[model samples]
Target chain A: MDLEFSPEDIAFRDEVRKFLEESYPESLRGKASRDEYEREDFLLWQKTLYERGWGAPAWPKEYGGTGWTSIQRFIFQEECARAETIPIPPFGMNMLAPVLLAFGSEEQKQEYLPPIIKGETFWCQGYSEPGSGSDLASLKTTAVRDGDEYVINGQKTWTTLGHFADWIFVLCRTDPSAKKLQEGISFILVNMKTPGVEVKPIITLDGSHEVNETWFTDVRVPVANRVGEENKGWTYAKYLLLHERSGIAGVGRSKRAVERLKEIAATEVSHGEPIIHDPTFARKIAELEVDLTALEYTELRTLAAEAQGKGPGPESSLLKVKGTEIQQRLTELTLEAVGNYAAPYFRGFPKDGDNAYPIGPGYAHMAAPLYANMRKTSIYGGSNEIQRNIIAKAVLGL
Target chain B: MDFNFTSEQDQLRDMVARLMREQYDFDTRRKIASSEPGWRPEMWSQFAELGLLAAPFTEEEGGFGGPIETMIMMEEFGKGLVIEPFLQTAVIAFLQGIIGGEKIFGFAYAEPQGRYNLNDLATTAKKDGDGYVLNGHKAVAHGGPMATHFIVTARTGGDQRDDKGVGVFIVAKDAKGVTTRDYPTVDGQRASEVYFENVSVGADALIGSGDDLALVEKVVDEAIAALCAEAVGCMKVLNEATVDYSKQRKQFGVPIASFQVLQHRMVDMFMAAEQAVSMAYMVTLKLGEDDVERAKAASAAKVQTGKAGKLISQDAVQIHGGMGMTDELNVGHYFKRLTMIGQQFGDVDFHLKRYAKLSAG
Candidate 1:
């Protein structure tokens, strides 16, 4: 096995490097560098990629994808991440677009794919409910069939970016009497602007309104909005969860976090020396870097498998279980590196929207919120516990 | 970037794994650890026949394979909890072009007062005409009981704790003024407190010329990487053993693996093990790089493996209940080995500081 990029791949990398250097917006970079980006801050860079015909790297070519090889896609992501660019939200692009292309009807495809490609429509997942998260198949959300519409009634909690989303893909029970809990589910798409739909904010420990509780009462969803067959949505839902978990590995982002931590540690002082000079603190950074390198190699191997026509399968669970935890760890170390500056309003509340005024170094303010927000990574995308059981059954046959 | 091993490497690993499963079961290993000299000569010859002892040296050094090969062998050895000095003798010194024959080698560097500092040597080797007279004590010389020769680090010119003026000398175990007090370590391996009382050695005994301390440090870093690989292998076993135990041991009329809390803990252990494996691979990848990058990778791997080892070993025993604590169970032994691995080369705290110092530069 060879790790060195081919001459052609190296040329492509140069091209990507040039584009990032020349076209990446300074204002968006400013916001992203501080973890204070709004939806628009994220959309700006995504729209730039869309214009350059590189928005969705993994989507099929027919669906406005770049059709780059797996290594090239990896390079593109590595470049974007290393440049500290805001991640193009996964819901509409990486998550929903894949499901739609694979399962959505031609009309559904024609309507949704282009909007997602252009970053004109924002989407969020409505899979988790207050009473049902890891045991997702046991969701109580109901979609009763009407003349031409399904009356939806449910509350979806931990609906990340729900306030900003224009539409949400939901899993609802269409047949309660089915033999298995999973068999009775139907995958339906709902407009957030429907009369009975409400988005109520749930401020997390970091005091950010990043997630919301979405209430759906008598929401009218047309039968045409359903993905694949009714009462067989479990199949589609499982497919979507795989895509979601696969992308949650966050290897690129963690690399950026390491870079940021190094920068902060090099500047922040403890006992008359930069904290980075302190063996204890530096070792912590080094340890994180080591863990990140491993996750990254695993991610690359997963990509190679994908290149060979294999879906993520249980490995996605491994990635999700490890990736999100690594992300959480970087934030924890960042908070620790910033020292008492991470004190003010940390886990207290986000007084402002997403941006909080700093008490010390410019980097300190983002530490607390980033750490608190990252806590959701393990809990969502199926709690790490469920992923292990999946590994036990599928990988180990235990 | 490419994580796939060559067919030869794969074959080697599989063969070693087969040997471990067939001949080095826990009971057999326990018997060996309890025996005099604390290791088996037949097993050592078996390793030599398998080319495991020669895996880290180049052909010019009269051996086949490289660091990757040695890493593969050490990992398998770790899985079996093999109480041999293959790492102590082969990878540690053979890489330094020091090993000559079947004679076991011991490194005498750490002292009574020298916590983790390689330069804090009170062991002095002053010149007396063509030969040098050495006088000092070396604490915790790993593999000491089995060592037929010793690689002793002594200060020749610089002050105590200074990095400069350090040198390494090869001394025979049966030398006139040498003494060793040997014992089994916490992890069931043999170590010794070696005393050097005006031991004389010829000028030919000096291994390398400049900055011998630095050379020793780099060699120790390689040893640390090998240890990290070994820890990863042990963690893999612990994770699997813990999961199997959970499936068999019933609690509240059901298998404990079915408990959500325990399941989550097991997953955490799995993640730790997997991450350690990843870091170990990374260290192997960075093995022959320039000193700074190599040291960074070693320290990073050391930290991750050390932490992961602790987490996996502890959780494995905790989940196994009282049976995990008994001498009859392999889980507790694995924990003991992991604990020793953490403290070896350098513990998490020590390497963390070293990592920070390097990053600052």
Candidate 2:
């Protein structure tokens, strides 16, 4: 019945807050936006957490995880988002690890889990292809098994952080002759530096290289690299997608963005007053806050259900759909608040030895790009439309 | 009672559509938008040759058309998501540069302190001898970088927000004290933070005399209508593109368009685009009405178009899925342009309140 955290949880929140305050790397302090984050920046933050034994907060305690309670995990995530920490990319820790934990062999777990948690390697997802985004089971990436290894061949587009990733978890068609399209697919890992692997950056509309089209021209991988039984990777992938959508409802980050939006609006002038003073702009922010509150409660309810030993169900798709809409709306409002400054597109702001000052406010540098880039939220992670499809069929049984 | 375009307007649309197809395809437009000048002077020459430069002026002013011509032209421009400054230099303002394709022009009305109020100008032109000395920053002057000349707003008499003091001045971009920091906009167009430090202009440079806020507002209303027309172009293109894409793109062994859920969405997009087309035309028809009616129509059309643009663009992107996200596709370009148009002169909320006020009165 209570909405407030327990006393112990509150204390744990404070402890985590204090830990972030003291231990968050000094270099990563002001670089809240992802534009400034290099591979080293992410590694620094992840390693800092790894050093604190908090790298994989949601993993089981036996798998080098803190094994915090669901509420504690929620609190930790909230604090990290509020602090605007560079997110630990989900490829290794969130997506692949869960798949590995659920379906990997003992040798695979023993070999990979420690390096993943220790921040020794970066992993990128390889489920999507040019022809196979929403229709993921129709993927054409093939893994023809050699005597001792699998010869993988196909291109995986939108491989987030593929440019610098140490490894990629690819979904390959191990048995193309199978009766069902979903049945032939197998989740397999590939090294990015293998003989035929290629990484070509796909510049987004924002003119930034956050994702890439990763090519594998007959790359080799040991047969041991496959997760779970052959022809059953669809089950494991669906499981991972469920895990992906759970955190896609980014209420914590959206709340922080709201506060940031308010600050920008307060500073931006409209009719001799701050834009926030304008009833219309104020109302949009208020509506956004209300929407975020509803989403927060929905997330909290899911977390509570998890605490009660129930897994997040098809309803988590609601969070993905709504959360992405809210996030997109945040970008919209931010661009609105920034006003005419949104016109200026900075390809790379204040690059090395380029001391030319940007034309507008420092906050405005990334406003439009972030707005353009944030469109990926709904499109990625099974798209908001697919999520809606999930809600219609799975939730409503229509 | 007539919503149909005149024969001339239809010819204009057909001509522009042909030029856009032949010369302004998606890749060419993208290249020019990112090129050294960020726009095509040659395109301006073609527009000028096609009599587009003088289309908005009265017949007395030696032009064959009015806002309707702009509406027709901008709609086609929207379909291509044309990156050139036709909106900036023609409908939004104008370019005498069309002759030699040399003298680009921009409208500098917005100020740092003025959100959407066309009258809230802090830039001033205090009279000195045969000219006036101008000093103030014009925020994000549309087509500012390429513009060799600017139609700027400055206060001649009263305080910042007062409607009575505003004066319009056409100043040369290279005026002694003028400086510009040019940058490409998010929508792949170019703009500048144009600063005026005692920049001087002759008395002749002033367009029509004192208290020009009403003139500015009227021009803005026309511009908003023109923008609405352009947005409808974007929405219609996007809606159709989404339909085409969904029909081609398959998921679950059928075109995603086959899903009743998606079918409903495309229907919504189509309907929104249709309603927006009606509003754009309505506003154009009302552009010559009395002040209050014109203002109301403009605001109402802006609100309709802005809200419609949001839905159509987002849904278009959503339906196209990841392909919509890539800069390689035309969908994202159209989406970005539609997004920028939402906040161009006044956003949906601003126009909503404005429409409400005018309606009450």
Candidate 3:
């Protein structure tokens, strides 16, 4: 019932704050604070946190993590988010690691865990095929059994960070003739360096190459790399999807964005006074703040359920839908705050050679890009429309 | 931070909700609305007996010592379209208790030209020998016609636009030269315009000495909180009614709820209700603290609740199709109540302006 942390937790928070102040590289913090971190910068930040034994605060201590309590983990995340530090990539820590910890063989854990903790491996998800997003069970990615290895052949579009990834975990149809579409799938881990694997860039409307089309052309993966039971990959996939959806709540990042929005609104002027002085805009921010506060409570409830040894259930879908909506609203408000500074399309901006006077700052250069990038949040992970269906069926029993 | 009510709060809510549902059903409300007084005094006495009337007041002032959160629970009272003076009575009770008054009281703030601004008072109270002579007319004064006493805000010195020098007085409803033009509002509740023509009051009538405008502002802000809670209640009913009607009513040989568009809209309605509930709860928690903070939070809730209540009620009626607008239908009651709730305390634009001003500062 109490909102305040204990004295010990407060002290722990102070220690974490001091460490963040001293240890996070200034250049990396600058990029993170500006929301313009590159792949290398993110990796270096992750490695720094890992070296300090502060990476993956949600993971068990035995897995080279902090193993903090749920509230402590939440506090750490809030602080890290508010501090504008680079968040550990969810593809490695939030999405795949949990699945590997739960369903991978001992050898698989030993092999994947260390590389992930050491920041030596960069992972991208290979889940959504072109025709099989919300209806994911209809995926046609085939992984034919070939003696001691499976040959994967299919395309995974919207592969976030695929261009930077060295590894990919995929769901492929292993037994096409199984009764249920879900029954035929198997989870496989493949190296991006395999001879037949290819990645083609998909430049988004934001004119950023953050996403890619990953093609697996008979890419051979070891049988030992298969997670859990063969053809039972649907279970593991569901587990991973829950983790992904839960992470998509993005409470920490959104809180930082809200603070940034407030700051920008306070500084940016419209109608003579700062835009934040406008009641309409300020009211929108206040309403968003209140919604974020409620979302935080909903997230804590879900985490409390997990702390009691329960997997994320249908309620996580609710968080995903509302969380992404809030995130989109934050971006919209940020663009509104930036006003004319955010008008130049990223593609229209000069990139090389002679004419290259940046319109505002590097941050303003990414506003349109970030806005365009966030357009996929509701579509990926699972479209909010699909999440509502899940909530209707599972939570509301409609 | 927990979002759950304590077991005792839950029990209290359940008891009040049940009493409202059983005793103040739509049929009973409709019957009372057509009666001479427009509201049933027997029901008010029943609420008093159940301690619902005293729920938000302190024990020393013939009340149950309930926090503002208890007023939020009273939102359910609005859901049933209960025709009683819970809000008017409770707010006045709290104010009177705070200012050391023993009698039941009612608020008189809204004026014919005030629009929705509580600060736009044209009333004047001039100092007389050992007392004050009040001269003003107040509109939409809920329970003013029946209240034992009235808390009337009047400009003592400064200009009408200046909220400073605005003083609040406790005048008995039966004070000399006081007259009430009472009538039933569209929501089937009675409110009155009380005219004070040189109505003199004793020294004790003044709640606080000289121009403490902040106290008057605080009272108005708390009254807005009470209204927001009631609006949340009204919207909750509207949401449920919409969902239920959409589930049962069939079109094209299937329930309308089967359509994704309607489902999404219902989800939106649910979200609005959820946000309003959260904001109302937070404002209730801070009610006893900072006045400015309470004003900001309450305005936030009012803005959200007012808009949501209107949207949900309108959509609920539309979802019910033709029967929704009929006086015979219960959903229409919710619709009427929601409309009334929006206009009460302050409407969406009023609160939004207030919120913007506070946040801007």
Candidate 4:
């Protein structure tokens, strides 16, 4: 009944705090902005965790996981936020590894797990295509057998970190004639260095390069790279996404953000006083915090259930919905707090590559860009509308 | 009390709509946005040729009309997603163009710190003998790359954020010590980070008597009304696009528009666009009203436009799904424009507060 941490959990939390405080490289300290973190910076963090035997806390212990309870995993993510450490990209460890453990062959696990653990490889998910986004089952990227290899040909867009990745696990259509659009999809891993594969940046509204358009022109991949049986990638893909949705509540980040919002309020002036003095402005923050608290507990309850070996259920859809709404509100408030400073755009096709001087306070620098980019939070992984539909069908049985 | 446009205004709308529909397709707009000058001079000439740019002036000035004409023209521009600077050059900018009466201009009022406050300026028009020495930067000067000149706002008499201190003056784009770093915006329009370092301007460059915050505010309110019409136009296209997309995009073996939940969303979008339509008309007609009434109408209309624009744009993209995120699709561009429009003159929050204040009085 109590939400208090047990002695063992407190001790684990301390160990995590110490590990992050000491092991996190100073060179990459505050420089690890989201998606802007270079390959070396990410590798540095992963390698640090690897040395501590904490590379994959959520993995099965036999396969080099920390074997901690879900609560411990939650504590680790929170501590990382408190420490302001760089976020580990999820494509490899968080996403691919879960699917691989559940559905991959022995050879696939042996080959991929070690590199993922050691931070020797970068893997990106290739589930989305230009034609298929929310209707992911309609993806048209094809992979056909050509003797020992499969000739993969198609374009995948919104490929987050595709430029930095060493490998990609793509969902390719192996049998287009199958009755269902979801049918005949195969999960196949391909080396990024393979011939006929190309990567081009797709700059978002924020003018940042976090995603890319990856084109594969008859890229040849070994047939053995396929995970599980033929025409069964959809099941594996859904499994990976379910794992992602459970963690997407982003409780840790939003809590840190509420504090940031208060700080911004205290600093920004309104009517010759700090905007926090305004009852209406303060009330907005209070209301947002109240919503966050409810979402946080909902997430905590989910984690507690998962700790008891109850796999993340469809209720993760609720967390995704509320969590993203809170995330977007935080950005919106920050944009409001910055007053007129949100207009000074920092970079504009850097003439000599120096667009250094941003207008106004440092807080205002990322406000507009972050607000622009956070629109993707609701749209990606699965849109909130889709999550609602999932709740309607899966939870309410409508 | 009337919502109907005058016959002349109707003709103007039809002319602009036809012109835009023919020459300003999505592909054409994208090409213009990416071009060297960032906008077609010929388009500006065409606007001048058709007397569309002269909508701000009286008939004797060889112009057709005023606020209502602007409303009609900008609404059409919004539908076509016109990337040119008609709002800046015609509706909001000054008239003392030494180049020609037909010379194009960009309005450069936004400072690095001015958010939506026209008075919160760091750019200075320091009194230097018979002229002023201008120094400081303007952020997001839309149409900077295309304009032969710019109408800039600066502080002349009082401290920053003081109403009495703001001055509107015309500055040449290629004036000595004036530098423009140009680039395309998220909404497929070109804007610049324009800098002035000790650039000199003649006393005649002042638009009004200088240091007229009321004058600045009046222009801003007028611009707000015009922007609202544009937003209304944006929302209508977004709503139609979403509804059309829903009927065509099938999932689960049926068109998504058949879903009750989605149909309700489309209905909400339709209502928002329709409300925006009423507000656009209300604001345009009220531009002739007193300051409180005019400002209130502008803010009230803008608040609705901002809300409608957000809901419609976001839902438009949501309904269109992944195709909305791509550059190839016109939906994302509208989404971006509607987004930037969300905060252009005053954001939803700003207008909400402004409307409340005006209401209290």
Local distance difference test, each candidate: 0.80, 0.86, 0.75, 0.83
Instruction: Give the poorly placed runs of model 3, Cα more than 4 Å off.
Output: A346-364, B1-259, B262-361
RMSD of each: 19.0, 1.9, 19.9, 3.3
Q: What's the residue-level lDDT of B61 in candidate 3? A: 62
Decreasing DockQ order of the candidates: 2, 4, 1, 3
Q: Which candidate is the best by TM-score?
A: 2
RMSD in Å for model 4: 3.3
The candidates, ranked best first by lDDT, are: 2, 4, 1, 3
- Which regions of candidate 2 deviate over 4 angstroms? A350-356, B92-102
Tell me chain A's TM-score in each of the predictions.
Answer: 0.95, 0.98, 0.94, 0.96
Counting clashing residue pairs in each candidate, in order, gives 1, 1, 0, 1
Candidate 4, clashing residue pairs?
A: A340-B115
- How many backbone collisions does model 2 have? 1
TM-score result, candidate 2: 0.96
TM values, all candidates: 0.55, 0.96, 0.54, 0.90
A126, model 1: CA deviation in Å? Answer: 0.9
Query: Pairs clashing in candidate 3?
Result: none
lDDT of 4 at B255: 84
RMSD to the native, candidate 1? 19.0
